[model samples]
Target: MFFSVIIPTYNRLPILKKCLTALEHQSNHNSVENYEVILVDDGSTDGTLKWLQDHQLEFPHVRWFCQTHQGPAAARNLGVQQAEGDTIIFIDSDLVVTENFLKAHATALIQASKISDRVFTYGRVINTCNFEYPTAEPYKITDFSAAYFATGNVAIARHWLIEAGLFDTQFHLYGWEDLELGVRLKKLGLTLIKCPDAVGYHWHPPFALEQLPNLIEREIQRGRMGVLFYQKHPSLEVKLMIQMTILHQVLWGILSVGGRLNERTMAGVLQWLINQGKPQLALEIARIFLNWYNVRAVYAAYREL
Candidate 1:
């Protein structure tokens, strides 16, 4: 089946270069006839549009589009609406994949369709900060994701997305849009077939003290949007996924000393870890309070609602 890889990007021009170049060089080991990369820019303040325009010759397989500052949920919906292929692969602009990425997803999807039509393929994503050689990074325990259907790397039929009502554009914030779509897909009997061979190296800047305020804001946004997710589904699973449960409240509360051990309190320790060249560990440790911030935000949003 032909593939349309839908990627929604914001101000991520540097990594988007690697992501698009990787998609451009994908090998057709499964003999897939054609694959297109649909890049929907989410109103980036950076020079992403001009750069993509200038480097058009480098990305011949890309079918690019742009929208206002709506979140990725709206961007992916636009991509799916404009996609020319039957199969659609959702990925972030920060993910750089191997040459066989599309081929692996296509092959697994074709095989799964033989058994059942309602099936999609999920690929591996390894996080790294090395922009020079992102693929060289090895998988770590921190990289393990138990998420059943995150959009970092997953392929589905275009028709299935339309049937599931596409992504709800109400998710105008930082998170939970993809997993909310996953809930609808799950109800439609879609099976997730794992394709570990199709790997994507997720690139992000190393954690620094300067990023704390933005990171904390993202957690708060995620918490608020997560409430929207549960408002739509209103199920136990959605509640758990959004960390809206009392258990999450107690867990993060105790872990963060009822919000005292926060970014301000732990700034020195986090900075020391970064100075010691352990940014990942620093980020993980910072999550202790970040999660508490999220839990508090979610509860506050719930109260507002």
Candidate 2:
């Protein structure tokens, strides 16, 4: 086999079904015969395990494994460990692949070295969901350059991934692990080609007003992880940009909240301002707007409940 597709999913059985259906369709195509699908259940509480057990209709090769709730990184690593192919393609359970998606990724990895000796492998993430967000047109192969690469849907050499140490298991959430891996691969003189030809539709339902809190929490964590990226790169321009962005978010929160600052957000705002060399100004802003995000997050959580 030339490739193995690994999908790590948690409590999203219906979405997984959609993704598998797409994968099965892809497998029927001539280019996908040499691939296998490895679906790793990340300790889903939903009846995903039962469904997988009942469905054995093989289109592309299908296999399932269950593990304790160790987060997506561990689940992916487990999938990589079980893969028998030279290359492993990682896709989310909530993504439906296009007919040419697998072929494009495989072709890019195979031909990447010819384009540039520095290019080792590549991956791409394309938005294909057509409901609310605008769907993107077919992308060319050259889109997967080193400057722009998305991790959510990526294909890489299996052994090279092992050599790169796979994903950082410390990232127990949904972000940063991809960037960390990309940075390391770049450091090793490997160029990540963004194969825009690989496209997939997001299977999750349209965004709901009720789930805003989780989004806010994820953004806060994203900001914190941005700090980690700054620490690694340590560029003054980059630092200023991140700090300013966070400050802007805080300012917006304050404006929305009628001037009450949340304690946690206030700390983030103040800390961010201090780093930007305007502590007093940042303090004044935080004193007012921090409560706004707090209230927003609170209301968002209540709505979810």
Candidate 3:
């Protein structure tokens, strides 16, 4: 089946280059009958549009669309509206994939379609910060995700997305948009078939003490968006997913000591981990306070409602 890989990108031009490059070289085993990359630029000031326009020859299968500085939700909506393929594949602009990525997805999706038309294939995503060789990163326990329908790497029929009303534009923040859409798709009786062969390496900067403020802000934004998610679909499952339940509040509160063991308190330890070449460990430890901030922020947003 032909595929439309939808990518919504902001100022992540560096990794986006690698992402696009990887897509341009899908395995020969996968027949390319108009397989295209639908890159929707979310009003990036980082010259992403110009780079794509000038380097059109480099990415022969790319068709980019532009919009104002709306969030990824809006950008992805635009991509879906303009996509020409029968099947849509979603991946972030920071994810670089293997040469056989599309082939694996196509194989699994075709097999699923043979069994039943109401199924989507979810791929594996390995997180790495090694820009020089992102695909080389091995799978780790930290890479495990229990998400039902994450947009990082997944392929689904275009009609299913249209039926689900696409992503909620109200999620104009850092998180929960994809999961919120997943909730809708789930209700529509869409089965998620795991495709372990389809792999994408998710790239992000190594954890640094200097990034703590932005990371904290991300957690807060996620919390606010999580509230929006619950407002739309109030359920016990969503409550757990967004960490809005009393259990989450109590868990994060105790782990963070009511915000006592925060960025300021854990600054030295975090940096020491980074200096010791263990940024992943540092990030995990930082999650203690980050989750506390999120739990508090979700309650605050709920109160504001």
Candidate 4:
């Protein structure tokens, strides 16, 4: 089957160049056919569009499209519309690919198709070479569901994806959209498979300890989305467990942590609790903290941050 590797990028031309170069290697593979690289320029102010055009003459297999400053969700949907391949594989621009990455996906689909009608595949990162970048790993993959959903690097049957509907553009930012898709696909009874042989090298951003405030804000935004997700699927007990577990950990941090890091963690948790609408629940969180430490000191620091 033909393969379509869709990459959605914004203002990261250098990284995109490396990704496309990897795609070039994939196209040269003997078994792959009618393969094409769909590069969606998601309203980049950088010279991304110019570079794609210049490379158009060089890589005839590459196709380029542009949209006004819409997010990656919209850009990917556009790429799906234009893709000619039967199987669609998506990889983030700020990544490197193994030689067999695309081949492994194609292999999985062909093998799955022989036994079943539906095929959804995902890959893992063998080693992340560039951890100092923003795209570096934050969440633990081992914690991911058996459906093995991760947008960092994955492939799916084009027909199956269209049937499941594209990503929820409503998310509009860095959070939960992939989980949203995984939940939807599971509800539809699709087969999700993980391929360990195929790997992607990710370049994640290096976060400093002093950046706790900004990180807390980002988590707050993501946490809000997580609440919405749990609200929709009350049976997903893991979601509730994670929320309560984080609260529990922060409480432990207040008593056990001695340095600035522990203090920051406790402060951040309290800030998160205050923004939450449930005052009673916030009080409970505070009570949990008090269970191990001086309630008055913890309460004062909680309010200070």
Candidate 2 overall lDDT versus native: 0.64
Per-residue lDDT tens digits for candidate 2, residues 1-305, read: 27788999999887677788777766344444578889899899999888887787643478889999988878888899999887788888877777777878767766775676455444454443343332343444533344333446777777767877887777675455666666677666777676767776654443332334565566555555555555556666544433434565456665746544344445565566567766445544543443344334333433443
Whole-model Cα lDDT per candidate? 0.92, 0.64, 0.93, 0.66
Point out where model 3 deviates above 4 Å. 30-32
**Which residue pairs of candidate 4 clash?**
133-204, 133-205, 134-205, 135-204, 136-204, 136-205
TM-score of 3: 0.98
**Model 2 spans > 4 angstroms off:** 27-33, 58-60, 115-149, 226-305
Residue 33 CA displacement from its true place in model 1, Å: 1.1
Q: Estimate each model's TM-score.
A: 0.98, 0.70, 0.98, 0.72
Residue ranges of candidate 1 with Cα displaced over 4 Å:
none
Q: Please, what are the lDDT tens digits per residue for candidate 3 over residues 1-305?
A: 78999999999999999999999988787444558999999999999998998999999999999999889999999999999999999999999999999988888888888889999999999999999999999999888888999999999999999999999899998999999999999999999999989999999999899898998999999999999999999999999999999999889899999899999999999889899999999999999999999998899999999
lDDT of 4 at 10: 88
The per-prediction tally of clashing pairs is 0, 8, 0, 6
Q: What does candidate 1's lDDT look like per residue over 97-190, in tens digits?
A: 9988988888888888889999989999999999999999998888888787899999998999999999989999999999999999999999
Name the regions of candidate 4 deviating beyond 4 angstroms. 27-31, 127-147, 205-214, 237-305
